[model samples]
Target: MERIKIHFAYDGTDFAGYQVQLEKRTVQLVIEQALAKIHRQDIKVFTSGRTDSGVHAIDQVIHFNTPLTLDCSAWRNALQTLLPIDIQIKHVEKVDESFHARKSAKEKIYRYQIINQREYDLFKRMYEWHVIKPINIDQVKIAAKRIEGTHDFTAFSASKSNVKGDKTRTIHAIDVLEEFGRIVIEVRGDGFLTHMVRIIVGTLVEIGIGRRDQSCIDRAFATLDRQVVGLTAPSHGLYLWKVVY
Candidate 1:
């Protein structure tokens, strides 16, 4: 058997989350079904990470083992033909058998988009969070900077996450950028807990709108209480931008 790595992108709006669920359409289930058809057996796939429902991906990574001896290009073409239109395989290559997608990942970058205008763009309604109030960019920047570095991110994580272990994670950077009337928040981290990025963005937005103090991030780190953080930004606005291995 050979281990294959596949890089793909998908529009997560129509399907459930990346993982498989009974009686639900999901990216993993669809891809697995496609692989089974090609391999004539059950083929399990592993992703770099699980993206929440309505959270799109620009370059998501997955790896699977197959006994078939097809080249990378052939594998890509076959998967593309079998997969749905919304899910596109960008590239494929053979990898060492030891490589595991989720465990081998070094860092991940997530981007959250916000529209800070009163008149929402009809084209961007599904992809961006529209906030009617004017947000203070400078304040958001300051808050973003404060969130950089390693911290116990329990406050920013979902309270009911099934992950059992230390919640401490390292934030390599949090960049706030504005382009064409859209506010973009990009967070690069070693690892993230469930809903961590959305919670951070929501807190920063609150700080930008003067609802939360600039020091709220610091307080959240110190307190480690979910209630101390700001709202959980809607999942639709979040995107899994990249995964560094």
Candidate 2:
């Protein structure tokens, strides 16, 4: 058997999420179905991480074992032909059998996009969060800086998530930038809890809109309460920008 690694991207607008689910279309399900056809048997793929519904990905990674030996370039070409148009295979290569996708990941970068303009662009409705109110970029930057470094991110995670064990996570860096009419918030971290990036973006948006002060982030960390944080920014605005191993 040979282990293969693939780098891919997907538009999550039409899928339930990355994982397979009953009675729902998902990125994983489609990819597996296509692989099953090629391998002439059932095949399972492991991903670096899962993205919530409507959360797109630009550089997602996955690995799977197969009995059939084939060139990496041929595997990429065949998989691209079989998979749906919304999912694109970016690169593929053979790897050691011990290289698991999720466990081998060193870091991940996520980006939240916002269009802070009066009128919403119909074309960008699916990809960006449209906020009509003018945002204070300076305040957003200050809040982003405060969220960097290691801390317990339970306050930023979804209350409904049943994640056990430590909630502590280290955020290596955060960049808040404005280009054209879009405000982009990029965060690089070792790992993340459910909705953590979205929640952080929401809190920053509150700071930008004057709804909350910069100190609110500190308070959220001190209290470890989800309610103390700002709104959970919608999933559509969040993207899995890259996964580093």
Candidate 3:
């Protein structure tokens, strides 16, 4: 058997999520289906992370062990040809048998985009979250600074999240950048709880809109109360930017 690593990207608007569901359409299911068709066997692929519904990915990585002895490009080309239009395999490399995509990841980067405008464009509606209210960019920055370093982030996850083990995670950095009328919130962390990045962005958005003060950020963290945090920003605006190993 040979272990193969695949770098891929997908527009997640149409699928349920990255995990394989029994009945619902999902990214993992689609990829497995395609791989099954191409290789004439039931091949299961392991991903770096499970992205929720409506989330996009640019540098998502995955690996699988296969019995076939084909070239790396053969696997990539075959999967691309069988997969849907929204998903594409960027690159494929043969790795050592012990390589595991999820466990080997050192850091993951996620970006959430907010359209700060009065009106929305048709083309951008499905890709970006539009916040029409006036914002204080400085407040967003202030809140972002507090996001850096190691901390327990239980307050920034959804109530329905079934995150097992410890609630503590280290955020390497958080950056807020404005580009072409869009406010982009980028977060780099070792790992994230369910909806953690979106909740963080939502809280920052509230601070930007003056609904919540910068002090509220500390309060939420200290209390570990989900109710006190900002809403989970829509999944459409969130993207899994990369997984650094």
Candidate 2 vs. true structure, TM-score = 0.98
lDDT of 1 by residue, 1-245 (tens): 89999999998888888999898889999999999999989998999989988899989999999999999999999999999999999989899988999999999999999999889889878799999888999999999999999999999999998778999999999999988778999999999999999999999999999999987788889999899889999988899999999
Residue 203 C-alpha lDDT in model 1: 95
Which sections of candidate 2 miss by over 4 Å?
Answer: none
* lDDT for each residue of candidate 2 in 152-219, tens digit (9 for 90 to 100): 99999999877899999999999998877699999999999999999999999999999998888999
**What C-alpha lDDT do the candidate models reach, one value each?**
0.93, 0.93, 0.91
Per-residue lDDT value at 118 in model 2 = 90
Each candidate structure's TM-score, on Cα atoms with residue i matched to residue i, is 0.98, 0.98, 0.97
lDDT of 3 by residue, 1-245 (tens): 89999999999999999998889999999998988887789988889989999999999999999888999888888889999999978999999977889999999999999998789877988788989998799989989998788888888988878997788999999999988878999999999999999999999999999998888778877998998879989999999999998
lDDT (C-alpha) at residue 73 in model 3: 81
lDDT assessment of candidate 3: 0.91
